[model samples]
Target: MALTIKEENQFKYIDEGAGEVLLLLHGLFGALSNWEGVVNHFKSNYRVVIPLLPIYDMPLKKAGLDGLNSFVEDFVKLKALNQMTLIGNSLGGHVGLIYTLNNPDKVKNLVLTGSSGLFENSMGGSFPKRGSYEYIKERVAYTFYDPETATKELVDEVFETTKSIPKCLRIVAIAKSAQRHNMAKEIPKIQHPTLLVWGLNDTITPPLVGHEFNKLIPNSELHFIDKCCHAPMMERPEKFNKILSEFLETRPNDS
Candidate 1:
């Protein structure tokens, strides 16, 4: 039986630590394992719950997009999470955005790193559409500043996740959702204090997107990390930790 939820798309979760609740959602091609470096930092001060997104296993027959929606619903329902802080990276960031928009009162703070919800506005060039292999190639290249930083291991990991059944379904679901899902309209309505963290050299989402988010969302703050690319948490954990800790600690009250 699944420890977290009853859905067919099972998630491996680490339900440890205590204090204020901090739910971490990973981006596309990412799992809870990716957040290992950051979880410990928050463990002592918060109840850190890292949910492994539906990437590897496929338990349901529904479209991957609906499955994701279900995943979020199940997560919120399974635990009485209130006044919690939600943090997401990459595709996970996109998910977090939607989660907050839907359940604004549930989230006290929002943190998105190198998120991927905005339209194509790259300083380098336009991104390829979602389906083609060239699109994947360009996205991979765009996510990093230094080409050499895109190690073979990273490439292989990316490919493995994309080629999987669950991920493919998820891609289709998110793409469909993105075409019509414009959080821009609801941005002004989001009352949670938000932190938008972006890599200055990020070509995928670009710093402009973060700025746009900051401008649209009422109480949002943007922090740009120079000399970094798409994955700021992974590219520079020390800085990421410092910024994150400061934000969570200074949130006035649990609200």
Candidate 2:
């Protein structure tokens, strides 16, 4: 029970369990809860850490790739985390990719879900400018294969979170920073074993980008979840967990 509840920080993280560490980074506009279900699944076997990433609603924390990367690096050193299996979704994936590239020795395995660093994504046209139920509902619709997942409760939750101007500004900075990334050239240089899981119907990052990452990252494997959108962990947890478990449990050179 004590291990289940996360202590607060803008970079708030929930840490639990023992053995190897599985650090999870959720997609943009996501909180620790986004990966809570996944965390619970692995907590008994792995030391799971899911951080509440920079969000539009999070106060004071300025958002940028470098800033986020610095935070993660510091988090690693402060926690004395080593040989971790990094699992990230979307923007989180992009951050994890950059961190892994810079510190390959620290990462045992890398798993990215609909990652964003491989290619440029022009997905902004789907979102509205304000914090309204309908506006957030529409935005949430774009992240999942089934529109029903973005329920009114979810919309209300998202709307309440984004009701600040400063946070929205932070979001803009993060988005711009994301577009500035072109890690494709460096992807081949990453020697760590990577697993790229993508949603076949992911209009946000798209499957084409997954194909590109698969080609770029050597000693890598790609798995596509059918009928899924931006988030396979949320949309198809059973299949997602199975693939993730197999990948994480395997040794780098194991056949």
Best TM-score goes to which candidate?
A: 2
Residue 48 of model 2, lDDT score: 93
- Candidate 2 C-alpha lDDT tens digits along 1-255: 233555544446789888888889876677676775677788888889876665564334557888788888877887888889999998899999989988888898999998889664544322346667666778788788999877777778767766766666777778777888778888899888889999999988899999999999998999999999988898888889988988876765322
Error of 1 at 45 (Å): 1.3
Best candidate (score: lDDT): 2
Candidate 1 global lDDT: 0.71
Reference-based TM-score, model 2: 0.90
Candidate 2, which ten residues in sequence have the lowest lDDT sum?
A: 120-129
lDDT of 1 by residue, 99-153 (tens): 8878878888999887766653332122224345555665566667766656666
lDDT, residue 42, model 2: 88
Residue 179 lDDT, candidate 2, scale 0-100: 81
RMSD value for candidate 2: 2.9
* Residue pairs in clash, model 2: none
Q: Candidate 1: misplaced stretches above 4 Å?
A: 1-9, 55-66, 120-141, 146-151, 164-169
Q: List candidate 2 stretches off by more than 4 Å.
A: 1-3, 8-11, 57-62, 120-128, 252-255
